[model samples]
Target chain A: MADIKSPVPGTFYTQATPDAPVYKAQGDTVTVGDVIGLVEVMKTFIEIKSDMAGTFAGYAVENEAAVSAGQTLAQLDG
Target chain B: MAERSAIKRLFIANRGEIAVRIIRAAQGLGIHTIQAYSEADAEMLAVRMADEAICVGPAQAAKSYLNIEALVQAARDRDADAVHPGYGFLAENAGFVRAIEAAGMRFVGPSADTIDRMGDKVSAREAAQAAGVPVVPGSKGRIETLEMALAAADEIGYPVMIKASAGGGGKGIRVAKNADDLAQMAPQAQAEAKAAFGDGGLYLERAIQSPRHIEVQILGDGTDAVHCFERECSMQRRRQKVWEEAGAVCLDEGIRDKLCASAVALAKAANYVGAGTLEYLYDSAANEFFFIEMNTRIQVEHPVTEMITGLDLVQEMIRVSGGEKLRFTQDQIVRDGHAIEVRINAEDPILQFMPFPGQVGSMRLPEGDGIRFDHFLYEGYQIPPFYDSLLGKLVVHADTRAEAIVKLAKALDELSIDGLKTTAPLHRALAADISVLTDSFHTQWLEPWLEAGNLTATP
Candidate 1:
């Protein structure tokens, strides 16, 4: 199992906007550099890209939750 | 005769440096300050400094600062006599102003009707024209169809700008050089405006080339108004003003008088109350200015005007909101020196101005004559990433523009906020740039300068 962590401390979102669909689902194939989520810091959205290729397990944090830098945002299973 | 309803308890319905600035101003006037903060901002400097602080909601601004109902309820609960919406968030929200007034708490700004009127681009343009203020030639109102846009473009000439009627902060804006370009761009602009602001309305203006962003600061007491000269905010990145200067040196005395007078005329005509800024696009080549929009609240660059005019704009606004008359006549208000204000945002200048929110370490601030730093930072404070990147504003004033630049350089060098990245290096480089030194830049200058890797070599 691999964990994807947020690169910055901010509000994390699983969707592009409030009404949009989630970027990924459990058991979905995850490619390296694929945007799994976005971390909104200081009103600027920075995409949280995957670094390892695997199957998407699930989001470790709830949508719109405040997260700290290096906090686990998602999990990936090989 | 109107009795003065003194604002004994002032509730600050905003956050960050401007919140802290408001708290200080209120405290100076012996007003008990009640600062409203989000859950994430409980530990902020302003929360700690205010006479009392209350948590309105969660970390997100939508649940907190922008929660108009919650803010009004909180202010009422705290027995606040007045609410001060500083700058952003709901500062210009007409709904919020109405709610505050309905709740029996005075909103320290113009009336909700004034905000609604001036906030809309079409009505504001009409108001300016009615007041004899010059405006860019364009469609008289919102363009409902492609045919109207084409007709307006034909009459206004080519190179017209397609702008959203509901837009601010440079969003929903596009420039088209010709009729074909406008035909292709207007639908996209409308769609974007609908998606962003729930309005598909769009407007048009003849795009001014190489314009300097000049604004006049005016304070009105409903019956009378006076101007505090003007500010030159040409140095901007992404339509966000990075550096601002008072007494735009580029304007000759003749033009300056006309510009300031026009601003006062608008304010008087609108029966404007409190402090407001009338922004304009000045084509220095043509030596002409055109009114763009009116911000019906105190602006971020207000301190630079205060520095030069020796006016406490915040206090003045509060006083006016409390049924006070105009304090200084136009002839009595004097501009003494040149002032410059550089925004110190919490962004890594080396890494594309990305937001850098971290725990503050040891801090060193420049202090002396004609130097003022407005901020909400402390030694052990952890900056929350839920807000904008503006950490502070370092303002400097001197007898002349050149001397002010010299002082700004010295002050920037003396300041330090350890354990976080900031835009200090960018300001340092700009202070030494030849174009900036000679005051030859315009609204479109800084982005190109940054794109050319000007900040890469900064030490």
Candidate 2:
């Protein structure tokens, strides 16, 4: 299991928008180039993507939770 | 003049050293200090030092610092009698100032109308010209067409700077050396201006080669203004000043007098109140200085002026905002010694000055004579990845410019912030550089020196 980390400190969102479904959920398959989440800071939102293909295990941070750089976002099962 | 009211409780809408500075100033005046912070600034020094603290919004600036509604609401809820925007954020936002005033709290800066007048580069120029200040050779207003831009460029002479009337912060500016250059650069500058400022207005000014960046600090109480001399802030990168020193030693006494007078004239013309800085480009070859722009709020390097004038500017701003007259006249204001300030930012100079965010593992600050360290960082404080990377400001003073530089260098050597990459090493190099030591460099000098790896290689 490898943990995916946030690249920036901001509020993390599991979905693109509040009305949209979660980009990725537990046990869902994600691959490279997949935007699993978004981090909003300083009025800018950045997409959090997965680099390694795997089954999404679970999120370390809840939706809309504050996160810091290098903090775990989600776990990936190879 | 407005009716007078005491600032019994003051709220500072900023973070970092500036926030700390304003809080300290308010405390000195026996006014209770309230600090508004984002969630990320929970452990900040300003938060700890203020009389009261509130988290107005999340870590994102738009929801907190720059949000006029949130800031005004926080001030009102805290029962803050006044609000001091300690630079950046919404400091120069006239709309924010209006909102604060609308909430029945005095905004500790210029009036909303004054800010609106000076915020626009085009009208600011017109106001300065109306005051008989020497302005740069440029177009009267925003030039919309390439043909007009080219014609203005030719009239202003070669090597013209095409700038966005609505743009600032080192963006939407281009230097064209010839008509061909103008043709190629004007459209690009316009496009950038449109994208960045939501305004496509363009203007032309004759570019002064390797000019020194000098600025005059002025204090006003609605009708009258006085200058507190000038600061040589030519040590800049991307138009963001790093190290600043009070008194441009290169200027003769006569030139200095006129420069300062021009600043006062302009400030008075605009009916500016509180602390404002009028920036200028000093051309040594022509021995003339031309108005560049005006910063309508207390600037980041204001400590340099404070050190030299023995004037607590933040306190003055608060006093003036509360409808009090200036405590002292121009003749009574004494200029003492020399002062230098170096901004310590959490950035990796080796990595193209990228912001380095992390916990401050341990820290040791310089102490004693003529040294002032303004910051909110404590040991183990996690530097937020959001917001600006400025960690603190180190200011030092001495009887002479040479002594001030030496003192600043020694102070930098004693300063330490472990577990974070800082610009301390770069500033130390600048202090030791012969050109900087002799005060021979200009605004365009620092970038190429960094590009050459002088911070690590030569020094």
Candidate 3:
């Protein structure tokens, strides 16, 4: 299975907020439609969901890191 | 009392560097200023620099910059005596100007009627022709059918440019070199014209070969007007000016005088007041100048003219709207040195000038005796995607054109911006090229140079 990608160019957030519970962690088993992270651009937040079901190989980028279009985020083990 | 009273408080009805530029001018003149912005521009440099700032609406320009009611309401709330439309949003909107006047505040520009007349390209062309300005050979008015366009093209000859009569910015423009080409282009042009300008009216003109795009800067109060020389805007990508320079390098004295005189004549004919530009296509080899259009507001390239003429066009606009006569006569207007302006956009030039919006980390502008940078970018400022990618303008002036080009190259090398990519490298490379360095260029220079791997510096 292929990895899900970011929909827009922005900063990546792992969870809702720092004090809130983490949505997904490193090496966590996830499925299609599972919440991966959030991409925030210009104060607009959008959920990043996995398109394939598999254990995460950890995110390719760090939380709050600047990202560009077509940049890889996570790798799903087929 | 209203006629003689200077503008005490001015409201800038736009955003970005132009807003900042106006604010500085107003401050210098002891006028309190207010800047209105969209939600996306909360942290913009212009907002931070203004004495007062208010959020007009969301990121979308239609709800913010183009929102007439919101702009007028803000002007009223701030108790502004005059509203300067700057360049883009409502600068040429006749209705907005009328509303501002109706609200008992001065519109720092020509009367609403003049804007309306020049906003319509067909009427503007007729006005220019009547004022002894040479216009390109083309159709007289809007074309309703393919047959009509075909007939007009036949009379005007082939290799003609078809354009939307109601729009600018190179939208809905197509060139047909022959009969077969015209057959395939007419309907497509009409559809594009309709979609872009909400008007399907199309006009045709003879497309001169590699003509340089030149424009004369004119300032007026109602009774008299003066020309502030000309700017050569031939360097373009996607039909939009990327780089511009004052005093077209190729045009000789005679052609330059003719172009400037025609621009002044057209402005007088339209009763145009304030800072406006009359754009023309100058065929240097033939020494013929054809009037293309007149921008009914201040232009993005006005600074280059300012660099050469030592005039504050925006201040002139304000004083004129206050009913003051034009201070300078035509003969007294002088051009000193050569000046060039390059629009530095926050775009990845290698990616076809795609917008590269991100947090601007560390911004360092170029500095020199003759270099001037007009921008709104700041450290930690996130560039929004809802508007134009123009980050700033870098302008330079020197005693000679060759010296100006050299100075521009040096200034560009010193400039640096961290975070998202920009077109600085592309400009630097273009400046260093032998063709551009020696002033051997045309309107077709930049795009083809990039495509041919000329500007290969990585972003």
User: TM-score winner among the candidates?
Assistant: 1
Instruction: Decide which is better by TM-score, 2 or 3.
Output: 2
**Chain A TM-scores in order:** 0.97, 0.96, 0.86
Off by over 4 Å in 2: A1-3, A7-65, A72-78, B1-5, B140-158, B161-204
Q: lDDT scores for all predictions?
A: 0.94, 0.88, 0.84
Per-candidate fnat, comma-separated: 0.96, 0.25, 0.00
Query: What residue pairs are clashing in model 2?
Result: none
Q: Sort the predicted structures by lDDT, highest score first.
A: 1, 2, 3
Interface DockQ per candidate: 0.90, 0.31, 0.07
Comparing candidate 1 with candidate 2, which one achieves the higher lDDT?
1
Interface RMSD against the true structure, candidate 3: 7.1
- Measured over all alpha carbons after superposition, the RMSD of each candidate to the real structure, in angstroms, is 4.2, 4.9, 7.7
Location of the lowest summed lDDT over 10 successive residues in candidate 1 chain B: B1-10
Chain A TM-score of model 2 comes to 0.96
Cα lDDT, model 2, residue B98: 86
B48-75 per-residue lDDT for model 1 (tens digits): 8999999999999999999998999999
Cα distance off (Å), candidate 3, residue B414:
0.6
lDDT of 3 by residue, B1-459 (tens): 554437888899998889989988888777788999998789888788888988888766778899999999999999998999998889999999988988999998999999988888878888998999998888987897889889999998778898988877676678998988888998899888888878888889887878888899999887688899999999988778988999887888877888888888888877777999988887666667888888989899899999999999888888898778888799888999999999888787776665677778887788979999998888888887666778899999999989998899898988899997888888888888888887777788777788998776533
DockQ value for model 3: 0.07
Model 2, backbone clash pairs (residues 3+ apart or across chains), number: 0
Whose lDDT is higher: candidate 1's or candidate 3's?
Answer: 1
